[model samples]
Target: MPLYVWLACGLYWMNGMATVVLGSVLPLAVQHLHTTYVFGSDLVFLQFVGYWIGVPLSSMAVRRTGYRGAIVASSAITALASAGFTAWPKPLPYLVCSLANGIGMALMQATVSTSLIEWFPARRAVIMSRTEAAFGLGCVLGPLFASACIAAGRWQVAFALVAAAAAALAVVGAFTPMAARDSREGPRDAHTDAIHLANRRDRALVLALFMLCVLIYVGLESCVNNFLPAVFVEHFGLPATTASVAVSAFWAAMVAGRMATGWIARKLPYRPYLILAALGTLCTTVVLAATRSVVLGYVECVWLGLFMSGIYVVTLVFANHAFPDLTGLVTRLVTFFAGLGGATLPYAFGWTLAKTGSQWADVALALFAAVLFGVVGWTGWVTKRKSRSPSERVHAAG
Candidate 1:
């Protein structure tokens, strides 16, 4: 692995920690702010709004300053905003910080994903899964880190720690030697380009499906990470400190799952992998909805994480494989929907939980999982159907 890859992985690791930091501290933060869960959900919504805005801006930033400059800028913004958490300690200020954090995280995410896909076109699935696994590793540790801070009765320190890490990453980005644009760009295969261009409608349809999948998938993931701790506390009667452990268990399972996926995905066809993942997620959600045992809830979280781990990366690689020449655009569009889903779904979950209770919230998640399963199935059918066309057959032979 190159130095750049290591740097990218480190950045993603920080991103994972930053992404979960709010969720980890949310229950405590709500109490600290003297606010309700609805406000916290709004914070989550605003943060993802920043993400929604940041995805396109990330492309512009990359165009203007290249990968290193964009990354450094993002890191600086994240660090500054995160530091505000300790300074203000008010509802409005915290919302502003969360929004800024989302933008910074989104920028870094788009930059890293595009850079890696360009740099290693042949091994996209393997590399993406591994980097995503690095992300999962950060998620695993983030809750534990926050749990420690909460245990010490200094929950604000979690954001402070995140700020320090972001600052250090900015310094790292400033010093690192990133590949030049021309060198990093992958070659465009003429045959593949022609096949896609000739079937413009099919290509559009597939891209739309892919985007929809990303939207729902990301929303589902955000809901789980952000609300699972809350569920543990309110429904399972677990303490805040103990509830955070469920998040750790969930992400720990994701890390293991993604590591295995990086290898297994190379052999497994995209269609089956996606279908099975969705099916597994649906089953886990059902089990989670029905189970009342605290131990079973924790175990179900791990199972759910394992099932959901590879969907994003695998879908990303699958999309790029279908449209090789538009890696940057495809990445941006996918992540844009990702931000959209993350913003909307979790807010809805929070609202639902605030009003109806955890049982209904669990039903909502299971329903979403079922929809995701259906979407994945539809996407697979479309892709397979397109492949069987005469033009595709000729391209495959040639």
Candidate 2:
């Protein structure tokens, strides 16, 4: 019920909307910027590159300005960049603006992720799910906003709207009360965490597993979301409108799934729930790839979104609980690699399809699903082994 909780939700919503809105208005970007569509797409590549740059910048921002200040500053930067995108529609300036927007987006995600632990210690998993659900809701709305703007012959309005919302969020964040650096809620110091990791050899193993989980999960999810429309159009011979609807259905299911998972987290163990979700994702993806029926494809996408919804937020919550002292740093590391996956995986999927034929696409998805299962098993094993240790036993006793 704290103000920061609501602000975090708002931050996430804007972050989500900003990510896909550019793609939605890509046609306008190409026309106004006087660049080929192929070159215009480089804006996306540059944005992710900025995301990579923000990883280290966010750490420095937190060190210099604290979490609250970092969030405000990042939000302001996002607003400025968004407004600039509309102000200067030329390709060169647009690229710079997109890069700045990416930096702001990355910092916002990192700050909210680290802040959530202290903000909602007792129910971090549930709260994290809700935050991510807000993101899904933004994803669902962003296209609609862009479509409406384009329909009205004013696509630039979409960028202006994004800028206004981000600016408002920055102003609200500036006025909000927040925890200080010296607060008791502060995480363990770096030296103390290093000592604990040294004492427990498996800690490093657990962290490695977590990072791998993030990398694979992000890669798989990004590939599915970004390419599903193309798959529908090309393979099923569906209309573009129908393909778009399928994509919307996936995001809608994601929004519902996050809420459902948040409720499930209250009763079910995170591990079992994740395993169940993973199993469902594997089934749906295989079916999706194998089927040609539009109805079946739509159904599969819904189920796929439902299962995919829980993974990212849950992984983040687990990492925070596992390494509370290193949440900011660990989140930045995981998300930095996730950005790489976002940039690379779709290209990999396309390259594989082009080289080996489209049949290989399903194989790729299935392989990734198998990898997800393996990661889950590894996580469960690591958790069980840690539980058997004397330190864990003593902690359990307390």
Candidate 3:
């Protein structure tokens, strides 16, 4: 493996930890800030709003700074904002810090993903799955760290650790070797041209379907992560510390699933893999909705995490393969929807949870999972239909 790949993994590991930092400590943070759950959700919303704003700007950042500079700058911003999160124990300041952290995370994520796709185009899916496994590893550890801090009545320390990690990544990004922009571009292939020549309507439909998948998948995952601890506490009467462990278990399953996906994706077609994963997610969400046992709750969390693990990464790889010429644009657009989903869903879930209950919230998540399954299935059918040889199409017509 290349040294840069290891650096990318390190960056992703930090990104994963930062991604769930707020969620892991949400209950304690809210109590410390003397705020409500709704306020916490609002902070989540603001952070992802920063993500929404940052995606397009990330492209500009890349253009101006190149990959290394963008990575370093984003890391520095994340480190600063994460530190700011605990500096003031007020609502407004925390909100501002959350938004800043979101922007930094979005910029770094987009830059790293685009670079990896370019750098390892031949092994895109496998490499992406591996890096995402690193992300899952981070998610698994983040809540455990937060849980320990919460147990010690030092939940704020989690943010400090995130800050320290991001700062280190900033230093590493500065010194890491990266391919120059002009040097990374590969010659266009016939498959790329074939995609360009395909029916415009079909192409648009495929992209739309994939984007919808990204949006729903991201939203559902974010909602679950942000609120699972609360759900475990309220619905199952679990202690706050115990609830945080549920989050870790969920991501531990995710790490396992992603590690398996790197190998499974090589044998299984992307379309079928996506369909199966989506279906698995829907099943788990439904089971989770119906189950009331605390034991079942933990089981469902792990199952849900395993099923949801590879949907986002595999979808991105599939879309990139479909529209090879538009990898960068597709990445940005997909990430933009991811931000949109992450921004809206959790806040909506929080509001719904406030108005209704965890049961209804679980129902909503199951519904979203069903929609994801449908979308993935539809995308598979469309792509398969489109991919048939002209003779096959003619034979079918005959």
Judging by TM-score against the true structure, name the best candidate: 3
Model 1 over residues 316-370: C-alpha lDDT tens digits?
9888888888999998888899999999999999999889988999999998899
TM-score of each: 0.94, 0.83, 0.95
The worst-scoring run of ten residues by lDDT in candidate 2 lies at 186-195
Over 4 Å off in model 3, which ranges?
Answer: 180-197
Q: lDDT of all predictions, in order shown? A: 0.86, 0.73, 0.84
Return the number of clashes found in candidate 2.
Answer: 0
Best of the candidates, lDDT:
1
After TM-score superposition, the amount by which residue 397's alpha carbon in candidate 2 deviates from its true location, in angstroms, is 22
Model 2 TM-score is 0.83
Per TM-score, what order, best first?
3, 1, 2
lDDT of 2 by residue, 1-398 (tens): 56777788898888877876675666456667666434543666577677788777778888999877899988998999899987887778888998898789888887777777665666777778878898888766766776677678777777887798899999999888776222334222121111134345667788888888887887787666545555565577764434545556777888999988778777766666667777788888777778867788888878888989988887777766677777667878877877776656655765565456445776787778878878977886666556455786688789
lDDT of 3 by residue, 1-398 (tens): 56677888887888888888788888777787787788978988998998987788789998998888889988998899889976776788898998998899889888888888877776677778878899889898889999998899888888888899999989988988786233333322112112232678878898998999899999999988788998887788888889989888999999999988888776776877889999999999999989989998898899998999999998998889888889899988888899999988888888877678788888888888898899899888888877777777789999
Indicate the worst ten consecutive residues by lDDT in candidate 3.
188-197
Measured with C-alpha atoms, the lDDT of residue 219 in candidate 3 is 91
Q: RMSD, each candidate, Å?
A: 3.6, 5.4, 3.2
* Comparing 1 and 3 on lDDT, the stronger one: 1
